[model samples]
Target: MDGQWVEVADRVLVRRHAELDLSAGLVVGDGGCLVVDTRGDERQGAELAAEVRRITRAPWTVVITHSHFDHSFGTRSFLECPVWAHEDCRADLAENGAAARDTWARWYRERGDDGIADDIAATEIVLPDRLVTGVAELSVGGRRVVLSHFGPGHSGNDLVVHVPDAGVVFAGDLVENGAPPDYEDAHPLGWPPALDGLLGLLGPGDGTVVPGHGDPVDRGFVVAQRAEIAAVAELCREVAAGRMGLEEAVQLSPYPRETTVTALGRPLDGPPPAPGGREIMRARSWGCPG
Candidate 1:
């Protein structure tokens, strides 16, 4: 809730929101600056923009980490500027943004948080103007910010923003700290490989990894989380391959049973989730799957 900027590197700053403990990045290069993953709504985005102004007045380009409402909805406030995200991110927002907005709005209403619901409803959904599929390089001020989509994991649209100069990876929802991974729209079987790609990007040593929410973490943290995902992926693979039963797999899961059930329930590469995905997505709290 402080909305203060925590400088991780020379010019790379992170503003960790008190709400949801959401963290967004601001990289000040030489030419222009880069803002990673806008907040939840227009008000929040405006607040973020103002916070960035407190740091620098350089023109800013926005890179969305994924299409989740908390990360993409506030994007409209930064409109008229270049907004970047995975291609699937654009598609997801274009197709489901409104529905997600309505669902979250209704959810808040049910919880008697009419103020939050109203803010969500009032915020206009904005899709990415530019898209990143594999990897896209950009000059933020004078620094290089690499945006990458390492297949599908937390979400098909998850993008990892790597700041080599800063030795920090802005790992959106793909890597969550202080909470369990959200699998509402995750690719369970593919999540581990995606994390493997992240580890590869990290290379050697303990570089900083900023999760979507929570405090910044180190490589060891990611490694431990990676193993959890790997176990989940293997379990899902075994289940899908008919070598294991879902119930038995649940018993052996590394995560809590509910979280494990949710992870296993996610679609790997098949038709679609067996319903409840939307509701789970809508009901997600602090960007964490319930």
Candidate 2:
């Protein structure tokens, strides 16, 4: 096993990986099961799949939170089962996955991590067969799981998974725990409202949130992060309107300087580019360094 899974709620478990501090989730139900985000590459995916087997032998369905390599590349190992994600995710993978593999492989190779580099090089991208445009529900065994796409935020196709029975929401990369939000492919203006939709999932109850990376957080943690992100969005707006300088935005940002700089460079208006329209490769310096 890569690591011991923490049961955040009844039948809801989150497995944390040390490579990127990535978190993958499992929700076991009476009849079937739901897997949230496979690991980085095929080998990592295999390890996670083995972990899932240890938990329950029930059939599983996969949901990709976004098309980032850490969240999506390992999906091939869990194949032969339906893979679900935002509609744009399929397009993102189809358009940029190969480029991501090549770029990240080169990045790891330069860092003398040839094993991972080769693993990335060898990964055969698998597009999500089942796509969600807005929201969709799944019946995993007897429990209900909701997959919702609340516009663009972290990426053009960020997917949020809500397990209503357990009061758990896997918020993907929309909400970061240990680090600042990644703005490499983020929609700075749209991120805050997107989190608003994510917060809506918690309703009035105290629910557990398993972020794409780091430990599970409470609703309050997300609330604070949302404010931070909204602040960044405001900073982006100011810079766009000549009300604040880029340097000032960086200085005032809640995130680190480099992250703030990246956020400032992204579009301040409009949504993230649709798949095949424009693609931003994962920068080595940004979140989830490969």
Assess every candidate by TM-score: 0.93, 0.93
Per-residue CA lDDT of candidate 2, range 143-232, in tens? Answer: 999999998898889999999989999999998877778887889888999999999999987799989988899999999999999999
- The collision pairs in model 2 are none
Residue 267, candidate 1: alpha-carbon lDDT: 61
Q: Residue-wise lDDT of candidate 1 within 42-106, one digit each (tens)? A: 88888888888888888989999988878877887776899999998888888778878887777
Write down the lDDT of every candidate, Cα atoms only.
Answer: 0.82, 0.86
Q: Evaluated with lDDT, which candidate comes out highest?
A: 2
